[model samples]
Target: MPSTDRRHDIDALRALAFALLILYHVGMYYVAAWPWHLKSAHPASWLQWPMLALNIWRMDLVFLLSGVAFALLARRAPPLRLLGRRAWRLLVPLVFGMWVVVAWQAYAEAVTRGAVAPGPGAFVLRYWAMGPWPEGAFSGSAFGITWNHLWYLPYLFAYTAAMCLLLPLWRHPAGQRLRAACCALRGWWMLLLPALPLAAYGLLLAPRFPATHDLLHDGYLHPLYFTVFAYGFLLGTDAGAWAELMRLRRRALVLALVALAAYMAARSLAPDWSEARQALRALYAWSALAAILGFGHRWLNRPWPWLAWANESVYPWYVLHQTLIVATAFMLAPLHLGPAAEPLLLLAATLLGCWLLTDGLIRRVPWLRPLFGLKFRRPATATPAPVRPAAEPIPR
Candidate 1:
């Protein structure tokens, strides 16, 4: 159970991380060539560097927070029950929200690019087809409803399911022994495991892969993310273990900063050197992971006015914002909005529209609550009235 005076800083971190996701996606609107661009899209050349830099450490932070929240949830809740709840909460959204939201995005894109807009009947037909409507005329095939930004749900649900299966064994002595052995490896070697898996996965998809989150098929990296999440779980439950690691925060921060600088410099100097540059990026990614964990452990407790509200709204916003964003962008893209104005309008509209939809409509409508993750409440009941005050004045 949460304490009445809860330490809300962690929740605040979740909110902050989610809010950053929105901002980064909005940035994608104006930020030169985003990672999502295919060669056929005729994307702007200038957006590449900004996209690369912003893309580097964003989702890693969110994934780390997921690990932390998972550990916290497991502290009191039965693991089986918790896992079930997660499936309901996450998997349901994954299946339903993706089915619905991604279609809207695809529809908007189709309409914007002068393709035919599918009505309900045509939509049903197209959705049942093998793929999305043909990519722009030359691309040869329609782009169906790809995962868009919602790939995290399925990936996260898979990780949670794996964790649930391992929970019993993880509590066993043999499991403890195995974990200890793994931990005994030097930090540098330990780091290699995650990097190796990531590299192997990336190589499998290389030339074909764009390192963006929206691509559903590039989900092989999720297991690597899950490993880091599992470590975070261990840290939260093992208590002083995290404190000890956190003692190296300053060093981790320095390494993270230096690695990031090197990554930027490499990108600037040799934009064509993809493999070497990505390797540098991978190094900095790990460094950023360490820095965020250490810094979160050390300094994330400070309060901010928006944290609680942001926490409450973040989930609904995440679930509902994409369609709104796509629509908003499509609406304004034709306005000849300046580079600055496009991103600004998209961000403001998506955030404000999502928050109001969640806090206003969803919360008020019982049937709609599940979609927005609003808590169910029981109706108020009458209670015994307080005893009437004695006639003290008369006695006096």
Candidate 2:
């Protein structure tokens, strides 16, 4: 297949992943252990299982997909040009979202937690002045300003910039050897070997550095995420690797299930052995990632309008969804609605708000579009206003 032939499956998968994130953030409101911005009035222990199932691989899959995105862009633009474009694309949204979209999350959390007096407008003013908020306020109160979910944009931007420095090296013999090594992953090796580094990270660094998502101090994540990202960057352009993934799709799925089962069993059985738990967790995560990659390649390799729409709208939705969930949950929690109703209502409001804001507002507004990571809305060409034939030389 030509490199330019749109990878419809990857597009669909990306959309699905972000959608899952929104749902997962919603889950954070109810999960027993997640240190989300806010919690539901009725936290449920059962939420832990599903959240774990998704949490392990979700962000990793995104990092891999992002590398694929890098591969796609790198094919078209020169390294310097690509770096510039990426900086614009990622950093603008990061800044815009930090000021506009993400701060709301911090504000909402503060209000809900009662650390701040009740005033969105006033809190936004304080946020704009960029003072250190009360220590307990969510979203990096210590830093005085927080990027929250928009942190992904800056991280991606940084990674893209760093990769630019390596672009030239990738053509050298050593880089060629590295690419060869990565491309060689397939079959049983595909099922297991890529996970070793990740398992090692979990067992070793995770104990030392719990995920801060704070970029600067996040030891384990930097190595793990960047490595997977590099893997995606290398493998994304390699037809052999893609074919290998598709060919091993079923086995990957089987392995994924087996790994997940083993992980779950270990959690239940050991529940305290850090080594066993972390190892199984990594196994489960990587196998599941492989399974999704294969499965997406096999099944979702087609497109529809909704997929296109999702392709466009997903970033903004991601930017917007968590806040909506937090804001909505805060309002509804006081209603003392039963668990089922409250969660369902949160989902509905989140979906509706995201859709309305993304499609109805963001897509249509000329200025606001790019802030949410959208392209310029092409101006409708003006019709030739029914050209009247020069008035027959004006008979004048």
lDDT of 1 at 125: 58
lDDT of each: 0.65, 0.84
TM-score of each: 0.80, 0.94
Candidate 2, superposed: residue stretches over 4 Å from native: 1-4, 385-396
112-229 per-residue lDDT for model 1 (tens digits) = 5556654545754575463546556212224455556787887788778888788789779998877666445444453444455455544454456544454355555665577667
Best by TM-score: 2
The alpha-carbon lDDT assigned to residue 396 of candidate 1 equals 40
- Which 10-residue window in model 1 sums to the lowest lDDT? 34-43
In model 2, which residue pairs have backbone atoms overlapping below 3 Å?
none
